[model samples]
Target chain A: MQEKIKVTINKKPIEVEQGTTIYKAAKELNIHIPVLCYMNLKDMGIEHNPGGCRMCIVEVEGARNLPPSCVTKCTDGMEIRTNTPRVLNARKTVMELILSDHPFDCLICAKSGTCDLQKMAQDLGIREIPYQGEQSTYREDTSPAIIREIDKCINCRRCETMCNDIQTVGALSGIYRGFEAVVAPAFEQNLEHSPCTYCGQCVAVCPTGALTEVDQTNSVLGALADPRKTVVVQTAPAVRAALGEEFGMKAGTLVTGKMTSALRELGFDYVFDTDFAADLTIMEEGTELLDRLGKHLKGDKDVKLPILTSCCPGWVSFFEHHFPEMKDIPSTARSPQQMFGAIAKNYFAEKIKVKREDMVVVSVMPCVAKKYERSRKEFSVNGDPDVNYSITTRELAHLIKQANIDFHTLDDQDFDQPLGESTGASVIFGTTGGVIEAATRTAYELHTGKKLDKVDFKQLRGMEGIREATVDMDGTQVRIGIAHGLGHARQLLEDIKKGKSQFHAIEIMACPGGCIGGGGQPLHHGNSQILIDRQKALYKEDAGKAIRKSHENPFIQTLYKEYLGEPCGERSHELLHTHYFDRKKRWIKK
Target chain B: MSSVKVELHQKDVDKIKAIAKEHHNEPEELINVLHATQEFFGYLPAEVQEIVGEEMNVSAAKVFGVVTFYSFFTMTPMGRYPISICTGTACYVRGAETVLDEFKRQLNVEVGVTTEDGKFSINCLRCVGACGLAPVVMVGDKTYGRVSPDGVKDIIDEYKDAE
Candidate 1:
């Protein structure tokens, strides 16, 4: 048994665990303490993440002055007051000061009704600014995953925490002092020039309109209007699970058929499924994994064990920034976004006998990083890149709204044949531990020359940051680990570096909960972790699909037999696989 | 070394020398050495931390975290007359910020920073209750009374030429 600390807040005595933060203790007592920099009930540690934002201040009766409740620990017999007039007045003044430097145009802002700062001001009954000053003038960064409007920042430090502490990317931070303070890359460079993975974790955590996904609706509408281009749209496997929520549906409601119909109503020439490319990815990636395993068994000294899955663009970019040396360990298979883009430009263009340049491939993804992934030069095939424009699931909702399309009344429509057809293995690609589970089913059968007793690896599923499991297949016991979020990724890599991890394969996702809970996903009531209802809905989708395994997808089998011949063929390496260069070598070596 | 002079502690100077020794005699070791020194002290004095960070290829922000996170570090030299103004919530509502403004005007230096003429380093604490004393500003570990805007000049003049 441990000693309990007794603290009195607003005349009510409360007993809490030793070292419990004042903010957390207040929550346990049902005390409403307003916070900007604090997110509670999260699985991660809480030291206010970065403590740069001075928003969580509270008064203690016997103490000398107000302390930030998030950082301050409770002591035995401490007297605290949360709703005192003095604390209330101080908080109001600070909020006023923060808003003074912010932009005044909330009506036109993309974050109009959902911003936390706006909600807090409304709660405090603050309608007008008390002071006037020169707000920092900065042009919007407007990148793939995120848009930077520094003028809207209250310096709540949520973006910084999300980027550095949560994602462990260290791409954004506060530079300079006093009035010159701004969060940005070193020297305030453009995000395109930096090693940002475009995970959009920062955008999701932003309290105001300071950070948001770039609006590509204008470009999409322009392409739709253009007579010269034939616009085709493809949505990823995980997108349907959350798309229904924008129109009063539950978080995990499966809206796949409805979403397809809605796209058709919007005048898209073809509504393809990214799951087609996802199944295609499994074929290419699965083959590559087996080749590497074979090389390792043959005692190839250069063979890489635990070849990390490279399906997630955020994880791929993380490799470029941090572990460039381990780049070869990543499967050469381009993500589903690139796979669809390449085929649309190369194979599909040639088949339809249309000029590749005239075909526009639009990707609707749950990931903001996919937007950035589309812009990279490596994703291009010959003179044309695979993906033309990428939009988040939220942006897709915005598009439907822009067109005045009633999503609820939309009729169910099927995806275009051949490329649109996919398996349950591809459908589960949106959830965490999905890729490993999908690959294991096929790998075990191939290795042992027998069928698997269980298709679902229930042990490996869910949203835990890091999960490990081993299965006995034939004479070989396959060891595997799944890690979500970059902070957990760092731990796994460090463990690997220390020779503590002995695994045949490992799966790493730079963002939490894989693509379904991507940084670009819809923000729901401040609890950004993939809601339980949504996760259940995605698995339900997988359970209902006729074809559960990627290997069993007949279309993928036909694709290999007709065109590619083999997985690691010369043509496969030319198109599907890519290489990486070490960016941090000089920095680490020096 | 030149007319633009800054004074530093002997212990700080010795620690900087030791850091430089580990990084080889390469001149770029200056910034890294200065950051390590600032970790021991409170802040980097003038060219100290900048010189060390540039030498190590580590940016100044990395060096800044060392100074800022650790309560002891300072970028500017400590005031020959150090003044800590308490402008926390209780005092701020009681006009402690106004008192702090007077000190800044009198000493010609902002909070958490120092004056150029070897005179004062002004910093504001989160809180130092003496709410009855309301708006208080401490000068060199000694607490001052309800410091008003009118008393700013007198407080500085007393410390003038004392060093």
Candidate 2:
């Protein structure tokens, strides 16, 4: 056991493990040393303490000067004064200096209510900035999914930490020097020109409006208001888990019914669930998995082992940029969003006698990457995108509030028929490992031609960065690996590249806790418990469903029979599957 | 801050790849690889940095970040005779600012940038350890110490005629 370092915070006794920082020691004594740039999501294993923001300044007894509590180690018998007048004055001055260069346009800022810098200022009672200076300004970078309002950057380097360290995307970094320093892509190029995956984790962690999602709520409204267009909306499974938090509900509160009702109230003509498409995804993806496994077992050396899931657009972009040589390794199933869009525009539109061009398929996702994914040229036909627009869960919540809909008071409602029907497996798609687990549940029964007694595979469920499980599919062992964050996926992909991987199929989601902890989900504010809570809510939703498997979804069966032929068949491959491309030469800004 | 875009040909990419390869193509060897690439290309532009990043397995954005952070590295094309005027304490007291101003005026280029003809670039440095000479100006490998502001035109003319 590590020796506990005794410390006194505000004359209160506290003991912490050796190497514990002053912030952690003070936290034990219920002393909240205010911080702005310090974000530690213990559940997700992301701790970024750049110590650039001198907001958490605390005076140590006998020390030369005040030190930032985040990076300052607490020595044994150390006396830390967290709320001293001197420390308070220093903190105030530091915050004032930061605010002096920052714009005072919180009224119109997208992150006004949730901005950590603003909240910290209010907590410190910073009324007026006595210090004024020339502010650092830059042109706004508007990408398909994210916006880089660099003028608002406070140089916290949180987005830099997320982009480089957490996601390993390398899309952004701190450039220039001191006052001119701002996190941006190489050559100050727009994000679209960089190797950015558009995962939006940077936007999720940004304390200010420097990084934010491209708001498509206005576009969705325009589509709905247009009388010529028959607008259809699909909400991703994770949105139901986290959307309630936007309405002041608990972190993991499942608001599926209320969310469906609220979308209807917000004037959406047809409210569908992306889980239906997720079910279709499982059907298509599971078949591809089994097909690959069957070929591998038959000693087919040409087939790529450990077929990777293509549901995550961020992961797709990651591989397309980083590992283009292994492009053929991932399963070619279209993600639930694209699958929904393809079906909505082609099959559903034809059935309703609505022209494909006249119908607009909008998706309310728990991801900003879905915006980029929907815009992929292959997902569209004749220059018209299958999904006309994709709004985030936060955007939907904003739309609900903009329309004055009482989300809490709204009664529970069901999703529309045909496309709305989903299963337990589909609902679980919101969480990490849920896709492979869902695929396993269906693939097992489909391959063995027997019903699975125990539906839940507990081994495949957890918050670990990389998890692997081997299931006995009757006699044959089917190895499964699941990775949530892109960094962990890189590890697995690296192993596969070096021919060290033993898994048969892998599920990879770029965001931390899968879509429930998506970049576009209601901000967790570094509270990782929110991710766990959202994950739990999704599991609870899965447990309560009558149909536990995607293959068992009755609506899926009817669709396959009436319109689509078979899983991974000619029509399904054309609609539900897409090919990968070598994008190595694409983002090189030469 | 230089927004000049230059097309990197096959040979240029190969040159950067060779530099990165000599450094074992390791991510940790980014600084060393960049130093050599800058020395070879006369400057570290985004195109060259992108190639270095590709060869080094590091991100192009990070390469740019490192290049921008250090005064020694430059992304813009340096002049044929890149000029560095020392602005250290000893040099500053000896009128290094005036010397730098004269160079910029004669060259018609800002610091860290080349003139329109790309003949000269004006940059300011800390010190050259030549306090005995007080103010010092350097062009390529040649160092001119105790340089007055009026001597800047003579220095530019010498480099222009020789090149």
Candidate 3:
């Protein structure tokens, strides 16, 4: 159906699609070429090859000069020499020039071990820089979720591509030109003053120390060291799916048990799972969905049908800033992390006989936005936050290693009782299209008053950018929409705004592949297969779970029967659900 | 871009909306709207950029990026006397760096920043096609050619009492 081009690289011949770049063709031959300022998430349709850095250059036989292979397309019978002395010399020279401008402080740099630019220099065997001049510098901007050390930027524009093109948040861009050119928020304003959703996708793709997550490991360690405080830690489902990679394990090795053991060993008084709150989220949000459906079916036109899920903090802030007019359309359910916090600080704290201020609820999440979510004033009682510290999966790994715990040889252990209990439905919330499927499993049985023969909604699962499915609830066909990246979410919201949406409900997550590809997860380094593997791990976990439905989880049932009277009762409203704000009004303060 | 706060007037806001409307409020029309706003306000402050972003349906950060990318756009207000020095190859060969350093030393102000009294601001331009009068300096509309570092004191004294 498509044309193919035969290209010869390093005397090896290969045939690929007509538009395949030389970089991909070289990869086909297993000839690895070092790259900088080039990132390609082909699965999500994202490719940022600015060609600003000349590190991936190759010599074309017929061409006058070497061209960067990332952008140079493969043509018929094209001869490309990747490892020639000339090409190597040029690449090394470019890398040296980059290093000359960079600060020689890798030992203390935030991205020290994982920095791509550092790896590039090592791969090219660069020892010293012959060229030297004034290096560009700017004030470091420390936002709630991200840190921008502009001096380390290589003008890669990967963050720009992810922000403007993938997420459509448009919070960052290239601000200047030439030697002094830098990428920053508008007017170089701090991210707090910018229209940043604090999604942290920019931090995820950064090649240098220019962008990184706000390190909260020290605060978490401090809370653990505080003898007066009871530190209760909750690990998100997605964190288990990917945290293993930080310990030299495979991408999809589910480290749930080991992570729980590590948290306990690291001094957490209680090791809980956010999946419990995810199940709790289903209890409230599913009820709201059914209530809206019942009212809509009964001719109550005021009820907002097509209720959107409110589990993603990034998506919540995105809508708050971009689509505030439709704020009431989404369910008022707080994220699983916040729900765990509120319950830990209030319901669980009281059950354990610990005072609210004495119990510090820490969240082990696979997201950077969770940091910003924990900072929301409304999610606090008086001045004390619901979650005292939110650490990333990467940060948790650092702590486990810092404690000298041999993660590989350590025996797997189960989570604590009551608070750690979770169901299969909540486990699936780690991936895209998982939330709606989980909701469907619970909503269908409740609405139809029948048992589901199969729990897995195979029709509603995939890595597709935008997905649609229909579930027959008795005689009614309930339409469902699922989207992962915010750009796709924008399309669904735009359809709703135009009165053209046919779905009865929708689920949206800000990051790619849901929380598995979160900004705070172990960096995939442009390999999208890692994300796919992470998604599969979550589904694998869901399949192995004993209870596959949220409502059927006995602990959640007990939570409702004891502390929270009903699904959407007054207590649930106060502790589980929260409101949205029109952030456009507060975007930039005068 | 400067972080100083400036409250925009209703009429200036209306003018920005009109300029954006003239371009159908498209994201591509962002530069045109920014140019018109800077012309009206004499600078592109954060407040004016916010309004342009609102009218254009573009993010404010993106608008700031475009303003900073081009050397022509200024975020802070220009002083009563804006001084521009050419630093092109022709001028640099004729002691332009010395002239720039002399100005910085005399005014105790950084390039692109105004004096505390708002009387003078210094900037550098690449070329003005005045190689015949190499190392040229321009104060508002007046141009001084063949300028040396020794003449910097006299130039500052000329504008010292003009206010």
Candidate 4:
């Protein structure tokens, strides 16, 4: 067991584990110290405490100068004064210096209400910036999913840590020094030119307006207002699990009914669920998995055994850039978002007696990368995209507020028929290990020719970065692997590259905790417990459903019977399955 | 945003690979390897750093970061006759700012930039360990002590005439 040490903060004594940060010890005493450069995702095992901003400086007795509490370790009998006049003045001066270089455009900034630096300035009561000087400025970089307004960076290095340490994308790093210092790609290249996967993890961790999601809400509103256009909206499974937090609802609050009502209020002609498409995904992907498994079992030497899940656009981009050699190893099933768009524009539009061009299929996702994914040329035909617009969970919340809908009192409603109906298997796609588990449910039943007594695969579910489990499929021992976060996915891919992996199928979600902790979800503000709660809400939603298997979803059964014909058939491949490309040579700009 | 792009020669790529191999391609020895590359090539360019990144298994952005963090490394090529003006506190007090301004006026270039003609470039150093020679300017290896605004033209003319 770890040793515990006693420390005094503002005259109150507390016991904490040795090597604990002074900030943690002070929190035990109910003393809140404002911090800017410190971010701790304890559950994800990611902590960035650069102590660059000096906003969390506290006076340690017997020390010559105040030390940053976020990075400073506590010793036994250490008396720390967080609110001393000396510490207060120093913090105020440091904040003033930071503000002096920062743009005073919070009224127009995208991150005004949620910016950590703005809140820190308010907490410090900084009325004026006394240390005005030349401020650092850089040209704005607008990518498909994110915007880099680097002039507002406070050099907190939070985005750097997330990009390099957590995601391992390495598209961003701290460059230059002193006043010229900023986070950017090599040669200050634009993100599109860099190896950025457009995961939006950097935007998720940025403490200021330096990084943010590219706002597509205005275009969505324009489409909604168009009289000739029929704008149909689809909400991803993860959006409902966390959208309630944008209002005053608690973290785990399930707002599916209220969300559908709010979308209807926003003038969407029809409100559908991406979970419906997720069910279709399982039908197609599960069949593909079974075919590959059977072929490998028949000693097909050329067959790749462990077929990877390709539902995440960010993960797809990552593999395209980093592991192009294994491009053919993942399943060809299009993501649920794209699958929904294709079906809405083709099948659903035909049923509604509307031309595909006159119909606009918008998606509300808990992922920023979906914006980039929907914009891919492969997903478009003759310049008409399958999905017209992709907005994030945060953007949807903003649209609801802009529409003046009283979300709290909105009546519980249901999704539109056919395209809106989904099963419990589809609802679980919002969290890690969910897609593979959902696939296993159908695959097990289909492969063994027997019904599963319990649909839930508890062994495959957890918060670990990488998990492996063996399932008894009748008599065959089929191994499965689950990985979330691109860094963890890199390890599994490396194992596959070395030909040492022992799994028959693998699932990879680019974001930590899967879509529940997506880059476009409601900001947790450095509290990871919100992610756990969101995961719980998704599981609860799944448990309460009457139909628990994708094959068991009646609407899906009707659709496959009426339209798709059979899973992975020729028509299904045309509409649902897609191909991958080698993007390793794309980043070398001349 | 104006980004600087450089085309590397095959020899330069080979040299970078050699330097990386000297450091055994360890990511932790990135700084040392970068120093050796800068020492051989006079400055670190984007293409050179990209090769080093690939060889050392580090990111090009991180290699650029280390290059820009230290004062000794330069991204652009230095002019044949590089002019460095001391901007130390002692030198600034002794009218070094005026000397720097005069150099900027004559060269038609800002600090850390080369002239369009490629004959001269201007830079500012904190100190050259010659506090006694306050307000000093160095042209290549030769130091000019007590340089005034009037002498700036003479320094440029000396290099221009020599070429």
Worst 10 residues of 1 chain A by lDDT: A581-590
Please give the ranking of all candidate structures by lDDT, highest first, separated by commas: 4, 2, 3, 1
Candidate 4 lDDT for residue A419: 91
lDDT of 4 at A373: 96
Tens-digit lDDT string for candidate 3 (A392-498): 98899889988999898877899997989999999989999888888889998999999998888898899999999898888989999999899999999999999
**Looking at candidate 1, what is the lDDT of residue A399?**
92
* TM per candidate: 0.79, 0.96, 0.90, 0.92
List native contact recovery per candidate, as a fraction of 1.
0.00, 0.62, 0.68, 0.55
Q: Candidate 2 versus the native: TM-score?
A: 0.96
Can you list the residue pairs that collide in candidate 3?
A: A186-B61, A306-A504
What residue runs in model 3 are displaced by over 4 Å at the alpha carbon? A1-7, A15-19, A74-77, A585-590, B79-163
lDDT of the candidates, in the order given: 0.77, 0.91, 0.90, 0.91
DockQ of every predicted complex: 0.05, 0.53, 0.42, 0.39
For model 4, give the TM-score of chain B: 0.88
| Candidate 4 chain A, poorest ten consecutive residues by summed lDDT | A581-590
After superposition, candidate 2 runs with Cα above 4 Å error: A586-590, B1-4, B7-29, B149-153
- As for model 1, its CA RMSD to the true structure in angstroms is 9.0
> Residue-wise lDDT of candidate 1 within B52-85, one digit each (tens)?
5444544433444344445555555676678887
Q: Would you list the rank order by TM-score, best first?
A: 2, 4, 3, 1
After the best TM-score superposition of candidate 4, give how far the Cα of residue A405 lies from its true spot, in angstroms: 1.5
Candidate 2, residues B1-163: lDDT per residue as tens digits?
Answer: 4756778788888788888889999999999998888889888877788888888988888989999898898877888888988999999998988888888787777788788887888888888888899798889989898899888888888978773
lDDT by residue for model 4 (A42-136), tens? 87788888888898999988999899999999999999999989999999999888888999999999898998899888988889888868988
